[model samples]
Target chain A: MDATVTLKDVAARAGVSVGTASRVLSGHSATSPAARERVRAAATELGYRVNARAQALRSARSHAVGLLVSDVRNPFFADIAHGAEQTALASSYVTLLANANEDTAQQDTYLDVFLTQRVDGIIIAPQGEGRGNLRALEEARVPLVFVDRVVDGFDVPSVTADNAQGVELAVAHLAEQGHTRIGYIGGPPSVSTGRARLSAFLEAVARHHLDDDPALITAGDFRRASGGTAAAKLLAHHRPPTALLAADSLMAVGALAEVRQRGLRIGEDLALVAFDDIEWFGELDPPLTVVAHDARALGATAMRLLLDVIDGGTAESVVLPMRLIPRRSSAARPHTAASHPSV
Target chain B: MDATVTLKDVAARAGVSVGTASRVLSGHSATSPAARERVRAAATELGYRVNARAQALRSARSHAVGLLVSDVRNPFFADIAHGAEQTALASSYVTLLANANEDTAQQDTYLDVFLTQRVDGIIIAPQGEGRGNLRALEEARVPLVFVDRVVDGFDVPSVTADNAQGVELAVAHLAEQGHTRIGYIGGPPSVSTGRARLSAFLEAVARHHLDDDPALITAGDFRRASGGTAAAKLLAHHRPPTALLAADSLMAVGALAEVRQRGLRIGEDLALVAFDDIEWFGELDPPLTVVAHDARALGATAMRLLLDVIDGGTAESVVLPMRLIPRRSSAARPHTAASHPSV
Candidate 1:
């Protein structure tokens, strides 16, 4: 009836040596069948629950993985968590999800906690450059996988969307609408996704022969308020852009609010496109145009790669493709009839 | 440099007893200052990392709590998780979040995993009656708090919204707009919120002296697809209700899509109201009217309560109030100008 019934108690009840009891309980293949049967029966009779931590120390497996996301409130990350958790459950492994809240310090704190917990593996949508606890985790040689984003010096297997292709699709679609002056709201440069997408956007603009004004590029922290602030600055320019693109969905919503407050229609006055696709984006009056990728698939793939690493198998990094889903947000420009086509 | 440096090794290196080293490392106040200093030096010299599970067994404190939500993808629950994690982090604790995905079997599995992990406490938006792992958790007397929803027989401290008041407010507003027949799309009765809201809707209809046709009430699993199905069923009736109220935000979105497909303008042909407000709800061409509650506050309060229980305090249950935010979706009916006032 005591909660702290130990292996010694089970061993005594089974009339076996402590070493034999432990090996049987830890599922060691070398244990005799008779010893395993007696130890199991004794454990059941005495209601001896195995101390997971102690057992993990002996067996080097906990059957639990840690998933660290940049922000839990972001729908894209939420969808990813759902996919990863479901996949983990199917494999009989529990996922312990932690939110970094887009803060590098918070991400480090969680990485330390995951290490302390001794999870079988970890799948992370990393925040910034791998440093601090991330370095410690790598030094410890824990099974690790990157989801959606990766750190600078880490040679970890990752599941990420093709940022270059996604950016190109958005830019090309906007260019086809005859908008030569395109403004871009990008994420922070500290994050991999932010840097990749920004560089891709610049490359796409040059390839499409659009205006390359320095003032056209603004940055946000991948949050809604930053989108609003960035949008305000761009629209206040001497000659504002005819079209705007955001790096993420939250920022896009913020930009939409800003455009509305300034009495500008989304499709009519300024064309808008967002990087990530979300369910509610389609519900907006003039639904948003988005560079779409499967967030759930990304999460699921990361989980599978982590499991493979845990099983001592090497996994190749996967880069999923992206496509443009043009809605009313980037409809044809009214005056440029020759270059634009109705969508 | 070994990852498995034990307390015995630290004690041996420090020329002290293992008991003294363990007492010092576990922060037992009874340890002498000299012993504490010696153990600290030896631990640092040997690069000793305490196994969290082993320490949890000895100290019976893990500084980690499990939070089980019905669905991680739901913005409402996601907000709750954000609030809870922030509060936990402020207290120098970690939150291990698990998604039940609205399935009782999955909920039980996560609960079992939480117990095995030896979390300091748990906060759950529980599903179904108190059974399986829920009962086992109660028997174990692990510090527990319910958030948003509660089980039938558990006396756990909880933070929940006033579902009755929320439902009554929506129904009264619809009746005031001269909607004699209002359709109700509610959640499954297995959940506490579902039962509370359904009964409240029935009571409000009686109080307002409006039509209470049995055919007007329908239920869903609190999912988007179920909402669409329920909406279709209600709308197909020979005498379809003029106004529709969905129990949750996802269901509201489903109903919105259904209404649009039927070519019925929300504010003109049919009035729609949804429970649970989301950020994007306001961005719709005709913004949704919602029964609003602070989801983040609900999560924060639950974490605070669970922490109290963990500290062996008798925490009181909290019931958060809800209010109606009337928007374009529930604006005055065009033909019933005399009974309705413009919103």
Candidate 2:
């Protein structure tokens, strides 16, 4: 068996006290530069590996971050996580990802586990409607960052796409194409993004001087199935809107299917605009029009902020801009006078 | 500062030798029940942790596993990672995921980093062509489990979906739908899945008494753009195919766009089948026919296998079954001769 080199041996070889060696080797910055260099040299000569667990035990800092997300299966959340991972890795920190699966109980258990593991910080994308677990994370005083959605009065660093602006982009684009009666499909009101997007739709319509009908507004759980269900409700009304705005790409795809089921054509019959420009959206027939968030960039930025906080900076919040890409789906509203042959 | 309790303290309180206390704490079998009970009670009272890192150091075993993947942003890989995370968390092991971006240099660097980190084992889905860096992993005698792809002639465990059977299912389904000339659009042959899928497609077509037309087969790189490129090649041919088989969902989506560009409708003018059921596939105008592999289940199973190996079990391979889901896309192949009326 190879002989294990101890800090004491490094200190003796460097001709420094054990405390000085410890401070220098642990990067505590208490030792003089000359002494630190000698200590480092001696440690290198001895091939000394500071027992990470032992040091963690003494310092009570694991240098690990815990990232909890609603679902790992979702590409949107996954992109953010990748960004976090890249940032964390660059900062010599490890991130542990916990999947909440939108279950409060499971989220709570994972939070407890992470706390026990003594991570330096946490980044959470809360699942549905649970504040208890988030409150616990906040109170832990172990720097936290929230992504995609914001919690009211949480006072933590957060990164989110401009939900209202994104909605406005979609609505204004559709209105420009002469879509008077426009429909909105958003996620559940429980989530911040969902609520903001839905409200924004109404505000944007009013701003654009278009008729805001309560019957045209529908809400689902940000799922394609829910979008299909909501589209059914809106279409069954007295007269369906000429254009539809879905808050997510998945929901947009669902709306597209629902429209086709009614023997309607996208862009031509009913203009469509969805948010979150999912990967396949670009390749779709009459590729979807979208108010898009740079998913990967959003993730990477959140991670960088978390890393900054971990590197001993003050907490900050960042709201990223959204870009509206007009695809074939939102080319022109069919019934609009601009699209009609000489009236 | 909290006073640190030593193992000697626990040993004294339990009225047992330090060796006996160590054995009980390490979960090794002890001679007497009373001694075990005393050690357990004493440990509970003293708040002792088994100190996994210390045990690993003394035993020269790191109890850490590394999961290397091509890309984490893809939902397919993310599913596998989620599974691995669940398995690692349950087994009290740490799993590190490294994304290589399908770059050999990046893969090599990550592998080196894993080695320097002294992980107990590794699970890699190599970029498939690089045996150069793998020699180190193999020489370290680290139990390796390859997931998603296999490196030829490497005596390591691998877990992958049955790609051939999956392709056969798609071909048989298309043939039964009365599609005579089927075009196969596959990913690059460098990948194991892509190669196996293309071969299986040909085999299945031959078994059904169909001619193997070179013009009907085009290779892509498992991406949306590649799918479009492959589709264009097949479509531009003098004798175009009535049905198309895409090796992956992204490619299939590309194919969908290409067909639509030519004023062809899915389930009518062109029959389609795709591998990997991406989220939007079901919500497409006509739900896609897919050869589906549950990525999350694959990741979870691979992690389980790694845990077993780390826990003193021998290395083994796990082959997950693939399923073909028939949807609207493969409902019928339209007679283009009638649709065009001039062909």
Candidate 3:
């Protein structure tokens, strides 16, 4: 047992041939169920991990990478994924993607899966504080890069947008349009984007000398339904802001619906601006004004960084610039529309 | 050479220990590159697969499933993925997703990857003819299920929408609204949904005695850019149709942009209907009327079928129904909006 326990040792202990033990370890279907159970038990008792790690020792390359997106349903993230995937394809590596659903637990599960899958590298739009699998990846020296968002303590190479500048542009535009109060719908404080954008909103509002109402800010989990809930909360305040700025596009959609349901109109009764300029934003009734960041570029850059890391090259973190696209949703308007038609 | 070749034979041929041979076969990265190359060459020369098939014999369950979506960026497929992932998670299984990007070659690549990963089952929105990995999946007796789209000539269990009926509803609605010709933006004919929907449109037009102008039909590769191309082609016709029916949400978005670019207002200058009623589709300028299919249900159903197949149960193919949701996009109106407002 002390002399490097192998499949032979496990097979001997299980009273099965080495071939049977090997079949059981390889997960092939031709072996008897009884043999499977016995060999597995024997392997477990002998602490035999060679089955999973055997081939990993021979070649450092898996020709596969792990991509963890915060939410696949978010058009911004989806675009980023497309860009990353295309770039990876050009490099002859396939990406295995996992949706974190913006939950730390799901993120941990997928990172664990990626390690077990023995991928060569990883790119992630990280969620929550660095812990669990995120920390494990760093410790294991897995090639890693962050995209869109970064964890607080992780010094991983990343491709993130300048949230402060983007927020300032949106607020300055609204302030020029004579809006003294703006409701802010933000993502949870757990994520880096959420903290950065929210902080920027606060700074921008103060610089513009807008109303410092405590009720003006609400947070959502960055999912569609939570966005709706946050929007509703912001609107229910006794003294609601004359304009709304959602930190992400999904929340902006919810805010739009909430405003329309109240028989108010965007670009008229209230001004609106959102982060993340999705393509369909232009097709909305009022053409949502946005703090536009190239999501696809962020994804593509992250993949490049990961590849560099995999090749034993140094990877530098990148912060992409963001801009505001002015549209009808933030245009100054006369009091015209109150009742809205169904979209 | 006459007897069965084993990992031992390959190890002997490669001049490595049995443990080293096993490590190389298991894809472990800890072994030396030279050892890996030798072992691989030896295994190939001896036709040694016993090591690869060994663990597969244990339970034949990797607790992983493959989901090959047509396009992950499409909101419909994203919703489906969410549903399938949630369902799989509830059953303590993980799903490995791949994007075909509406390409047959990409589909083949992912299907082959799934086999090597030893996934317990696979759910695919298949593209092109039933060859390559599709045939390989059947021959290998891997649990397989199709969703959203299906390939011809394969008797695989599937969860597909009634595409013909969905198309029929769209055409009939347009006919009842007094449209003589309805422009159709459809997917490529290589996919089942594309063929079935197009056929249904043609049959419906004939039944209604509407003009059979061939210019009314145009096909896209099921991406946003192609949708724009098809719509532009349709609108450029000498006698353009009053109504438009796009095959999917992304295409509909492209068509909407094209229509607006031509200074046409939806529900006024041109009636538009589409398939796949995505969540935000209702939030478009004129809420799109759609032959709505439950995309999430399709995904969840496909996962259930795959699970059934994995459990050795006979999986019956499921065909879900589609319905029409009337919105302003398809409202009958005069051709009034020649100069559309920038939205």
Winning candidate number (DockQ): 1
Give the per-residue lDDT digits (tens) of candidate 1, residues B1-343. 6788888899899888675676678786556789889999999999998887867764877778999999998999999999999888876778999999999999998898888788989999998888899998988898899999988878789999999899988988888888888889999998998998999999999999989999999999888888889988988887777889999999988888887787676777788989999887888867899999999999999998887676445689999999999998998463643232221
Q: Which of the predicted structures, 2 or 3, would earn the higher DockQ when compared with the native?
A: 3
Tell me the spans in candidate 1 whose CA falls farther than 4 Å from its real position: A1-58, A332-343, B1-58, B332-343
For B1-343, candidate 2 gives per-residue lDDT tens digits of 1137776778899998775676567665423788889998998898876666756653665445778876766667777877887777665555666676566766776687567556667888876665767877787677788899887778878889999889888888887767778889987777777788888888898899876887898998776778888887887776778788998877888888877787777777778899887766776756798999988788888887775565445657888899988888887664652355331
- Candidate 1's residue-wise lDDT over A254-311, tens digit each? 9999888887778887889999998777878678999988999999999988876775
The prediction achieving the highest lDDT against the true structure is 1
Candidate 3: which stretches are off by over 4 Å? A1-60, A333-343, B1-60, B334-343
State TM-scores per candidate. 0.83, 0.69, 0.82
Ranking by DockQ: 1, 3, 2
Top candidate on TM-score is 1
User: Model 3 Cα displacement at B112 (Å)?
Assistant: 2.2
Worst 10 residues of 3 chain B by lDDT: B334-343
Judged by lDDT against the true structure, how good is candidate 3? 0.83
lDDT of 3 by residue, B1-343 (tens): 4348876788999998775676577664447999999999998899876633464552455678989899989999999998898888876678888888888888887788777777888999998888888998888888899999888888799999998899889988988878887889988999998898899889988988988998899998788888889888887876777888999888999999988898777788889999999888888998899999998899999998887676445789999999999999998542432222222
What DockQ do the predictions score, one after another? 0.55, 0.23, 0.54
